[model samples]
Target: MPTKVKPPPAVTFAHPSEAEIARLLDFYGVRWEYEPRQFPLEWAEDGRPTKHFTPDFYLPDFDLYIEITTLKSSLANRKNRKLRRLRELYPDIQIKLLNARDVEALFTKYGRRGEEMNATKAEK
Candidate 1:
């Protein structure tokens, strides 16, 4: 009998920025889960979840969730509101929101300006 080798899991990232962040985490050997959990922000009268907030990445080692937004400040308001609601509902959870400027700075620090530009273009 021959042994079989399993292929690596395939993950589809919603944005290029998320892929970049995953690469960074892999490079540093930090374990991460992409969009692994969704927290309910709003519920219907019947107890059904009407709105949810799913953070982009979860660093299990650090027990932290990260949400990345490359949108303009004005466009990010909805996400901001969702984050606030998530924080209020789940005060024990640790989550961080990285805005456009923060992500740009990260890309610049990692010499990935081209990828950052691509992400910006995709956002628009």
Candidate 2:
């Protein structure tokens, strides 16, 4: 008798930055999924869902969720707030946010410039 194993699902990216991250992860031999699951962060007083969040990537090998933000815009701030609430609600979930500076550092560590990945989408 043999056990059944499921194949990895195809990863899709809604933004160019996310595609770049997938490439970087692949280069490092790390498997990653894009917005694989949504986490509920808030519920209404009547038990209705008020808010939910889906992180950018899930690195199963490391058991971590990676959220990338190339800008300091209000949307990013909102996402940050959601992440905070998510953390408070699910303290056991492993997650990290990779802001512009962190992304630059990651590229530099691999002898690549963050700017090389199209400054149009990257942070200034």
Candidate 3:
């Protein structure tokens, strides 16, 4: 009988833009991982995590985390609050928040608009 081999875990992107960013990172030879770790921003009295924050990308080479948010005003406000809390709790961890405008700027630089960016295959 042949030994069964387990397949490697598939990398899933929560949004189309994440896939676009992955392509760019691959092109630049900048190794990156998607949501490699989640930091607990709030804990309950039982020591369980009540609130957590996860950055979109983690660049091993840069030793930093990049959070991409394309949410509207209200959602962005909430995201910003979480980021602030994450920073406060984990001061040593380096992370950056890339808002929609920043991502748009990047798209413009690559001559790939938002529509084209969404053309890339993404999970969820």
Q: Please name the candidate that would achieve the greatest TM-score relative to the true structure.
A: 1
2-85: candidate 2 lDDT, tens digit per residue:
998997666666777777777677656788888889998778999988889899999999999999886778868988898899
lDDT of 1 by residue, 1-124 (tens): 9999996699999988788788767655789999999999889999999999999999999999999997777758888998999999999999999987888788778775555546755686
Q: Which candidate, 1 or 2, would have the higher lDDT against the true structure?
A: 1
Model 2 Cα RMSD, Å?
7.0
Clashes of 2: 0
- 1 or 3, which is superior by lDDT? 1
lDDT of 1 at 31: 94
In order of lDDT, best first, we have 1, 3, 2
Model 3's TM-score against the true structure: 0.80
Q: Give the candidate number with the greatest lDDT.
A: 1
User: Model 3 segments beyond 4 Å from truth?
Assistant: 1-9, 112-124
Name the 10 consecutive residues with the lowest summed lDDT in model 1. 112-121
